[model samples]
Target: MSDSLDSLLATADVADRRDEVVTGVREHAGRIARELALLQGGDYGSRDFDTDSGTWTVKYEGGALQYLRYDGGREEVYVVSAHSPPDPEALAEALRDYAAFVEAYNAYVESLEGVLDDVDTDFPAVASTESVAAERDRVLDRIRAVSGEMAGQLHRAEGTDYGTFSARVDGTRWELKRERDQVSYLRVGGEGGIYLLSQYGNPPATDVRELVGSVPAFVEAFNERVADLDAGLSRVEL
Candidate 1:
């Protein structure tokens, strides 16, 4: 008789819990279904809310509802199963709130993406100033090498007296004359009277390296003259 009485009481409890689940879903089913459709991923749309009992959270995972409760005394959060306390009604309300938060969050992300797509400005990397200066130095080193070699060749050639050198190439005459024991002068003429290539008085050197190092234009002119003299030296004498 005692077993029979216990069975009847358990049956009533089951019936009451079933009624509560049904009532909760019926009141919020439309909203829950709509939000679940928008909420994607295995675990998303998480939101927390305060309740008379404590704090509770709701989310969707793998197309199913999940509920969580925070225990302040333990400082830990644990899952609230459907067969547990706080009932399905509270879970539904939290789910609706969380889903709404998710909707707003997704809309904001979409708007930010649109704005980024319209940004067309491009920033390209460029060489540093030090790298550019290094490149210029390399070019200048090559120039110095060629000029020194040419000056040596001209110094040894015949008719190059007192470091005096002259050559006419492409209708332009370039001349470097050692004027005194300590000084020299550079001149250029093109169907007109010769003009000084060196703005100031020059220093004496057999290779004309001093002149080449000092004046930019003189180095180019001097190299051209040396090249012509070198070609002449290479020819077979008749």
Candidate 2:
């Protein structure tokens, strides 16, 4: 397997291990909270505390060692996790950081839930209207350009040897083509109408005009269909 695939597998393994460690830490913390409540004579919710500050410590030989401390002024309990043996100071800091993070995360989640509820209640109709309008405008503009090109091709021809045409008609392109006694013209009419006219005999101008005249009704019909399609699309939901 590629190195990237190997790295992805390794990342998955690390994530699983991390989750296991975190779960063990949480369970250990919960036990500490229950014990603290029993000892301190109150129901105390546990937050992770910093061990480095002389507040908490742990000793983990097999899985995880957990510790807890009390903040008397705040009336809060803190849990500390030690995956391996750590000095008192390190344990104290880790536990303190964890507690702070948990508090912040809880507040953020509450605020987000409130915002989501408000959006669900108040925004669906307005969002749908705006979405449909924007989509209609975009599709209409595209169809307009396409129809215009097809209309213009009714007046021109296309070829590579006679150089190139830079003008756009409706949404189609017109170009001229020439080969010996014959001249070919191409009119590109968006996704639907594509026409090629090749005339032989003398200057080929008469044949080209005849070809264009013969297709006048067809070209007009195509333009009408394109307009109808654009109108239909404008009425779409989104």
lDDT of 1 at 157: 60
Q: Write the per-residue lDDT of candidate 1 for residues 62-94, one digit (tens) a residue.
A: 444554444433343333445444444444454
What TM-score does candidate 2 reach? 0.22
Displacement of the residue 237 alpha carbon in candidate 1, Å: 57
Query: Candidate 2, residue 92: CA error in Å?
Result: 4.7
The predictions' CA RMSDs to the true structure, in order, are 21.9, 21.3
Candidate 1 colliding pairs? none
Q: In order, what lDDT does every prediction score?
A: 0.49, 0.43
lDDT of 2 at 150: 53
Instruction: Count backbone clashes in candidate 1.
Output: 0
Q: Model 2, range 93-148, lDDT digits (tens) per residue?
A: 45455555445434544555555454555545434455555554454344334434
Off by over 4 Å in 2: 1-92, 110-163, 167-238
- Cα miss at 116, model 1 (Å)? 14
Lowest summed lDDT window (length 10), candidate 1: 202-211
